[model samples]
Target: MRRPRSAVWLALRRNPVFYVAGLLVAVLIVMAAAPGLFTDADPSRCRLGLSREGPAEGAPFGYNLQGCDLYARTVYGARASVVVGVCATAAVVLLGGMIGMTAGYFGGWVDAVLSRVTDVFFGVPLLLGALVVLVAFPSGAAASPWETTAKVVLALAVLGWTTAARIMRAAVIQVKNTDYVNAALSLGSGHGRILTRHVLPNAVAPVLAWATIAVGTFIAVEATLSFVGIGLQPPVISWGTEISDAQAYVRQSPHMLVFPSAFLSVTVLAFVMLGDAVRTAMDPRERRA
Candidate 1:
């Protein structure tokens, strides 16, 4: 028989998609963490005199209509996008895990009530619901951008978690009655112990996969909000704000729109691809392959 692939290499070896996605994601994390590694120019300082300049020596992405270094702005914009995406994803995982795990493990009326509530949330479209929530707290000044970011994060987290909750519930339900669970119950383990120690650990893997996908999803949602001039206002460097700024100048300066949009697309695609790879890794059929 052929030598078995090691666990670390299995995903990448069987599916090159993981390797490509992982590489792109690593570059983005680096870009988000240390933007200066990419450029030293200031994103905000603009010179209208050099409006829409094409790629040159120092500025590979060239100048925007306002004459700011497009490359620097794009690089700096990564931090804000990544932060919102990550924070929102964390909130989704926390809220969804609790509700989903509890309802799934307990069953009976608890499951019925939680499932019903999830359905109510499910009926509301995510983007629409998040818009309603964010509209309540509009951004006013540069000094309070965090306030807008926070509310946007809150809205996305609250509305986006239902899917995760449903996924976890399904996973928990699948694992709740497994032999290991029965073994724990027979050993007289308390409900909490069985849940935290046995049930949650096993059921939560699928949630991790969902969360990887959610990070990209929430980022896109933030961008959508910013595109509409609601999420991240002026003075906040975000890919969404950049896109909104460049949208009107499409005919005049397509590069302005292209660069940021490209970055945003790649980031989102990276997360989604990573999520797919994770999901595949967890599948028993894939393992046997």
Candidate 2:
């Protein structure tokens, strides 16, 4: 059953988890959008004199091995990481949703072919596939930040979309046979009109929930790839890159590892909690439970 807007809002409001997770996600967005609001210090400006220094007067988070302000770098790091997560999630949802909807609605051999392809892609692990793709088309030292980010996003989307496609395919199969859909067909509605106006709105809730969680998943994956030195390279200054830089200095400067890792963990957790909140609110059974 479709929930009324007011009821949905009420349900979200009633969940304390929703508020906490929403606040974290909101802060992350602000940090990504305007790091200067948090600190005026330059993220890129490095001072070799301050290398590996602990917290000081102006630099609360101190400096890293590269002598860049850890506070500033951590603040600015949100931009690239969030960009990769959001962009990759959008691509995966769009591509997977389209394929799933088409296959589910058209059925027959179309469904069989797409399902087989999805299974094959699903069989490949996300990280392994991404690693292979990244290695196959290495981003040279001269590649721009945007180019590097795009390659990571593309790799993630290609490998990670199977789950979304499968979810959407199942949802569409259940939805297309519903009374509203059948009624629309009997009322002389065109296939496109019925699909766009009726089917998609009803079918998208599950996908929305999955995409929410996938944002965090992709962010973590990006960080892992960067940590392994095949993901986002330097000059991009993602949380992953910072974490990678901190690997060798774990004992000497634990702050470097702790700060970025904490931020990444919290961000990922927030998304996951938000996804749980969404899922609970949308599903009457979960809400009742």
Residues 1-289 of candidate 2: C-alpha lDDT, one tens digit per residue: 6455556676889999999999999999999998989999889999999899988899988899989999999999999999999999999999999889888887999999999999999999999999999999999879999999999999999999998898889889999999999999999999889879988888888999989999999999999999999999988989999999999999999998999999999999999999888877877676666
TM-score of 1: 0.93
Model 1 off-target regions past 4 Å?
Answer: 1-9
- Per-residue CA lDDT of candidate 1, range 109-179, in tens? 99999999999998999889988877786655554767777888888888888888998999999998899
Query: Would you list the C-alpha lDDT of every candidate in the order shown?
Result: 0.87, 0.92
Model 2 quality (TM-score)? 0.96
Quick one: best lDDT, which candidate? 2
Model 2 steric clash pairs: none
Indicate the worst ten consecutive residues by lDDT in candidate 1.
1-10
- TM-score list, all predictions: 0.93, 0.96
